[model samples]
Target: MTATSVARGATTEAAARIMARADELGAISSRADALERTHLTPEHRVAADLVGAWMREAGLTVHEDAAGNVCGRIEGLRPGLPAVLLGSHIDTVPDAGRYDGPLGVLLAIEVARGVRAGALPFALEVVAFSDEEGTRFASALSGSRALAGSWVEDWWSFADADGVTLADAFTAYGLDPGRVADAARRPGSVLAYLEAHIEQGPHLEDADLPLAVVSSIAGARRFALTVTGHAGHAGGTPYERRRDALVGAAELVLEVERVGRSSGVVATVGQLQAFPGGVNVVPGRVELSLDLRAEDDASRDAAWDRIRTAAERIAAARSLRFDAAETYRADAVACAPWLQDAVRTGAQGAGVADPPVLWSRAGHDAMVVAGLAPVGMLFVRNGNGGVSHSPDEIVTEADVAVALDAFAATVAQLARRLEPGDTSTAATDEDRAPEAGA
Candidate 1:
């Protein structure tokens, strides 16, 4: 049989396996709601272990790293071909939907299974990354960044809302946080990487498309602002003589929303706290957490600057003290053009409707890997306007099947075209620095 015929057959088999696996996993009651109380607890680790076992069952060599990332590798027929990396995080936000991260990891395993059955020509590695949500730490994308070498060791000391440091949490879970360096990947082993995920937005559902090719992952900056003002009895202080901290905070929140809307960016004030909490007393101080994101770094920076300036001006005019501090920032990542084309072609081959290219407002582990290899992503339609990070998040089995088919087709194409000598060695350098938030 010709190479094209072999590839076509492999694609069919892979798609079938993916569909079956999606059904099996999705039906297992892995809803994020069930795991929320534990919050990155052993429950997630069990899920990762299951994924690793599935990869082994699919005929790959699987292992879990010190940082708890599960990786499965399939050897290539040609010794020199670069390995293709695929998969996503297994961790989810509190009350997250089941399909968000686990689907990508499982689909990658199905691709490997197809290669094994059909004698594909390239090496493949499927990974189920840990800690993408950062629910237990201030840092998000922990596992991916460690693999990319962008994570700082000092961050291990950072704590969660419960005041539990990453180190303490890892120890509680039977993992040694000191061995985090073991998670870092050698530079240049991966030639390309691809991830399949739920749209996490309403675009695909609204457009009635089964899939989407990600154009880029938006850059993000998080900040904490504090406003301090004089406190007085609510009944005793005249409205005109008072310097209410809540008033300044409220205005700043509105300003952030207004600026984001007018600039075509996205900004949200998700958390706010008040000091001296009592209805009878005027608010003496306020603290707010602001999240800003944009499709490009420049725009994200500009939006942050605008927000800071607005906050400072408002505080000064209201006779209050204002301070703002950055908590985290992730740069925008553009998908590789060739890989994107491959994704589109794969969807076409799968008999799915033409997939649209769209920007992702949310971040993913794939963004970190893009700096190490050619990277692209596929997104399945999510119901209810792509609502995610909630128990109500939903996606149809058919949409998942379609995404799986596309993922397999694309992996098959890459395997056939990869050359042994082309394997990237850039990741192997001992001194090579990992990019931030990789």
Candidate 2:
């Protein structure tokens, strides 16, 4: 058989493997609501175990690190070549959609299956990050940050709304928090990272695209604001004399919304609390959490400044005490250009119609790895305008198959690039952009 014939055969077989794995894994019902029965709590350890089992089943060497991150290594023809890291978190927020994290993990397994069946030149590592949701703890991206050596000790000291520290939660899960440093990987160990995930938004669905190549992950800043004012009798105090914290809070909220709209940035006041519960009493205190995000750090910073200025002015005008405290911040991350090109080329080869280059407003574990290695992402369309993080999140079987084919083709291209004495050129920037659909 000719070389072209062999290549075609491998492509057909890999596509079949991807679809098969997607069907098998999608039927397993890893839904967050049903996790309780499987001993898979929202905790990190349970997720780690679940990923380890999948990795083992895929015939890879699997293990958990001190941070409880589960990693599976599939050896390649050459042992010394840099390994490609794939997979995402197995953990989820409360009542999250099943496909959010599991899709990436299962896709990695499918990638490994393809490589094993057909000859590949570089090693691959399937990773299930320890904690990406930060449901039990205040810190998000625990596993990926640890791997990047960015995990801070003070983060463990953080307490949830229930006052449970992250360290205590770790201990309850039979994992030692003191050994988190063990999860850190030496810089330059990983050659590249690839993640497959649901778009979790309306873009792809609205565009009617099957898949998308992610260009950048947006930066996020979270802040907690407190407004304090004198509490008095609602009936006795005149409107002018009353120092209403709620009123001040309302003004700040509206200002935040205005800033977001004017600047074209994303800002949200997701949680709010009022003090002095009484029908007739004026609220003495109010607290709210602000989530601000943008495609870059400077824009994120500007958003934060706008919120602070608005809050300060409102508090001063209303004669209230204002406090703005930052809780968390993540810088924007751009995917490696080479890897982005590979993804586009592979998608084109797999016959995906007009895959778009897009940006993710939400953060992923992939962002953490971007600092350490070349990282790229592929997004599958979610129905209903790609609304995710809810029970209604959905992905079609056909789209999953498309994503799998694209993933497999990209992996194959990367493997060939790593072959001994292979000087094959990479896909150029022009190739990374989306093509017009037929």
Candidate 3:
């Protein structure tokens, strides 16, 4: 059936089922007071089982990959074909909301169940990637990276907070450490991948749109910066005589905010600590964490240059030694034009013409999967100012219903294109920004 003729994707049944599934998954967490599930843990395994059952019911052949990724697939006309993949992660950070990663996985299953009747040209694969939150090993996207053949040996040696090694965790989880490579999906076997997740921001809610296409995932860089000076008695040291490291750090923090505001980038100093911090002493040293993100790679890097320069100048003038080191860097990823068009077409087919598009500031399994194939994403509006990664995160079922319908339409639209080997014309990134709701 054509996308235009397809009914609302799996309806409220799908939405309700997703909510129920999320609750079950949420219950299998590490903490009684909050949701805290980590990779390669019992909670993760149970979640895999729970999602696997839904995949099976959707008429897809399901299994847990060697890397512990819960995967389900519906075959194409033949036994093998380049598959269209859909999904998000099942793992969560400490006290995470149910909607962030879980919602995407559930919505993908809903799409799969709704589209199985059409039996399109390409096979469909739904994956509940085992790890996207790096709570267990301090390495995010572990599951998707394995699937992308981007697994690094360094991660094996990675340890958790309690000094549990990843290799040890694998063995404890009854998974073979030697077989994680088996999860790597070959490059040519995937046509595209799509993920439906919470917007994780207030843009969609502010604009009163329930669904939006994701144009790109922002690139991010993290740093640990230290400013060192001399400590002195607060009562003895005059303001001009005191070389305070904390004061320098405070100035740099303000600079970061100003740059972020004027540059339209997101830069945060989430952590700040002062050595020799006392009510009666000038601080000797200050350490801070810098998290910077931008919609594009050039802008992100360029902004970093500006920030670093400003920090150096500020520290030099304050006579405080400044040292900064990058702890992590991930490049931005743009959604494939063909996939973006499919999402647009899907939204239109679902009765939303020119639906708003959004750029995700947060990372997801989609970023890692982009290494495997072309990627697209649909964002569901979030509640409570779109605050995610916490228990306060929430979603309205009506928005979810709308998101599922659009996601299903996206599946159908892509299926139609796959049948004919058609690639839609590429559009400018201006289409990626959120516009006033129509």
Candidate 4:
């Protein structure tokens, strides 16, 4: 076989293996009809075990941390040198796509497989964080926060939909809640973190690009709002006498979209409910969820203020009561410039001389890890108009092939930068850890 054809065949074979593995992991879901794996559940354990097996085959020492993060490591020049970490979460949202988390993880294992012992200046570690979606518990990034030494004690009291507290769930899953602190990595121990993930948006697909370098992860805040009004018989409630909560909430939802667009942020009301459902009675109370995200925290907070002001107006005009409580918040995280250069170099080696850069609106484990180490990300183009978190999420084998090659190249580029006496971007204060909440 000619050199070009042989190279093409190898890429195809590697890509096929990654695709096959994604299929296998996708089948181990908690739901019968769709994919639904959550933190510290039976399915999580099964998936972690399978991933650990793959890590072993890749020639790494593997273990499960106290927080239930599956980890594998191969030493570099020496046993205890500070290491470069590569990984993504394995948790999933309800009805999630297989590629969202699993693809990054499987690719990490593949990259490690290609790295021989003592190959770089720093050791290489791959972690499959146990939770990033917050699907089972009220809190997200449990595994990564633990790794970053940012574990919040309050999260232990957080519970799942079935009323199982995180502490109890840990016990049930064969982990000690107190020992979870051991999962934290000491500062200066991790050189940097790298992740490869699907874009989860249409940016790359619109540009017709197979890959891009991530600029930053957007800050996000979530809220639960309640609107209240008087309920009355449908026939008895005259148009002029009506105080409909649903109507008021519908208006507020439109206001959310309007303010979000004007402020250049993404606001979504994914869930809305009306109480006292009856054909003869009007809805008296409504509850809805608001997810707000922006490239910066200040912008996100400002957008929320505008949204709140709009809600107040709608409630007053409709003669209803509106109240909102912040449910969760995470500050935005910017990727390190040096790491971004490495990612770009990697993509350029994979054929794109000028890869596009995008800010991630979706959260990832890297967001939490940023608190501990310099972080960077590579985004693979998600097909079907970049649809994600659904069964329709699609990624072609060709894209995966390019992603693997680019990801491996990224590791190599970082290695070169880390070589002795290379001060161009060599671990400076610019790469200082972001705040824990970052």
Candidate 5:
């Protein structure tokens, strides 16, 4: 057989292994009926252990950090050289699909397995971040942030639905809160960070493309809004006399959608609750969540301004009081142009002459990693119209085969750029922007 045919056979074989490993991890969930492996939970440790074992099998030196992130490293041309970081989170959203995060990880291991000793200029490290979904906490990206050295002391106070503090969770998982910073990689220690994830949006599927080079990750801001008004008997209160908070909140929700559409942002009201529930009583208060995202911070914040103004008007007109508390905020992250080119070249090497570039509207662990090093992403097309965070999420073995080939090529492309006297690997001002999508 020709060399090209042999490579194709190998790619197909590795893709099959990745799919099988995804099934193994999928079976390790906190629930019997659904998938859930959150930060610092028992499931997280189990998943980390499994990934560590795979890394070891790939000839990597493995360890679990203080924050519970599983890391495996293979030396490059020489020991202790800066490394090219690969892989993705192992944790999942509640009821998440098997391929969303684990595919990238398993693929990274496959790439590491293919590397020959002393062939590259830098180390190869794969990380199975312990938490990216925040399924059991108020904030997400704990594992990546800890690795990026962006951990906030306040995060220790965050609690789960069971009222377990993040600090306590760390202790329960055999991690030390005092040593969390030890997970952080020192400045200049990483060459770049790359992640492969299933495209959570329909753009790739709609375009009929198997992969794309991600351009930027959207900035996101989340808020908890409370609308307050006087409660009264539903039967006794006339429409003219009613000061219904729920009604105001409903109007605000619709307004958010309208503003988001016009402002070119994505806004969602994922949760809403009415207080003092009674069958015969008007809702005195309503609490709702607002998630706003856009390609950049300025646009996202502009949309939020419009939404806040509209919300004020709705509250005033309805004789209700409105208040909004900012809960989570992430600035937009732009992928490095050179890294994008590397991904584009990688796709070309995989047989695509022109890989489309896309902006990601979803948040990802790569966004946090960008704080540490230049970051880029390769998006694998998702089947079922790009459904994710749900059981319906899918990726064909054909796509996985192509993704593996492209991913390995991207790393090879990086290695070439990192050769002696190759300044293309040098950081630029554009590298300051963060990147990737979930």
Candidate 6:
């Protein structure tokens, strides 16, 4: 298939709207020279203000919540009805690309603007979560977690690179850190969360499709691992006698890859360090960071189990000591089947029937929101082989057009499906239902 079908076929004024809005928001970064907005910063407040204004322009009542989330809402036909939440984060990683999180927020606003002409059964809420990148803190998804009623007071102590505590930053932002719990939404108040983001992977571009549906967002487990062994002179220590921690760690890294391949999970050893100042000296110790992810918790936990066993064996054979400390664990979440079908129907309605489906490996605010509401995502193909979280990240106008059209249709379709008062309760315990959820 040629790019002509999507790249040329999809050209709506809405694409131009999205493009212009993205550039405008992209310019509101923390750094004058680069995009680096983080949670509770001055730049973040500016971005939130801009998003709030756009939300109001989209015909919704807008405000910033206690946890600093930007929100705009168009109420349903009747009072006390559950809402359909459409959104993504507004924060960015350091020197990050403009599109990663903000595109979803902007597209969501555009979709709401498109459908404001009609009445829907469920309230439509557009949220620009304040902190998804965790750039200024250790815990990720702080905004969404607060919305999900999972806020932890301990996070207030989370310090940024500058040693400023989250509470201190919140105070600086004119928010009472103690009132952050007000950000949490009661369970069942939301029908679903729909996010439209760049694919951030190569599949959609490889298939020459402008848009795709997300199947599930991967659950991730992060660990800091250390391998300790005796230090000795590299030249004097015989290969048979040396107990090299770095060598043992290297072998375990391969084990991580091997288990991940066989288990169908994604395991990464992104950070590694070796001890000893001299290159000629044998490494005394080594530390590594392991990130393991899977679409289901069972598989992810299983992979971790096998990896632990392998690490133990490697250490035993090499006369090294092994230790691991888990730093983070976010459970996997699958889109509701009905919502998945809704996105597909929206794509089909937009003339891209049977588009490919992709699963997100990277974490997002959706992971936390999924605990409170069913979630669905629309993935627009990215240009330049899906490079993301960098200055190189990009999207084509044609793809944006397709995404805007499909996302708008998705709202209308979901309204029809949910009009019968059968709102949001289908997957209340999706976290535990691996087969059905995944």
My TM-score estimates for the predictions, one after another, are 0.87, 0.84, 0.94, 0.93, 0.94, 0.92
Ranking by lDDT: 4, 5, 3, 6, 1, 2
Model 1 per-residue lDDT tens digits across residues 1-438? 123412333344555555566445444443432535222466666676678889999888899887778898877775544577888887766655667787788777776766653254556788888878877675678778777766767777888877888888888877787787877777667777789888888988889988888888888888888999988899999999999999999999999999999987889999998888888888999999999888888998898888889989999999999998888887888877767877888888777667789989999887887656667889888898789876567766666667767777887566545533556332233322234342
How does candidate 5 fare on TM-score? Answer: 0.94
lDDT for every model? 0.75, 0.74, 0.83, 0.88, 0.86, 0.83
Task: List, residue by residue over 311-334, the lDDT tens digit for candidate 5.
Answer: 999989989999999987889998
Clashes of 2: 1
Give the per-residue lDDT digits (tens) of candidate 4, residues 171-290. 999999989999999988999999999999999999999999998999999999999998889998898999999999999999999989899899999999988878788899999999
Best by lDDT: 4
Give the per-residue Cα lDDT of candidate 4 at 55. 96
Better of 3 and 4 by lDDT: 4
Model with the higher TM-score, candidate 1 or 3: 3
Candidate 1 lands at a TM-score of 0.87
Lowest summed lDDT window (length 10), candidate 6: 1-10
Candidate 2 local lDDT, 70-173, one digit each (tens): 88887766565557888887666655666777778877876665456224555678887767777666467777888867787888788866777778877876
lDDT of 3 at 295: 91
Error of 2 at 255 (Å): 1.5
Off by over 4 Å in 1: 1-33, 37-40, 117-121, 159-165, 168-178, 416-434
By how many angstroms RMSD does model 6 differ from the true structure?
4.5
Please give the distance, in angstroms, between residue 5's alpha carbon in candidate 3 and its true position after superposition. 9.7
Candidate 3's C-alpha runs over 4 A off are 4-8, 420-438
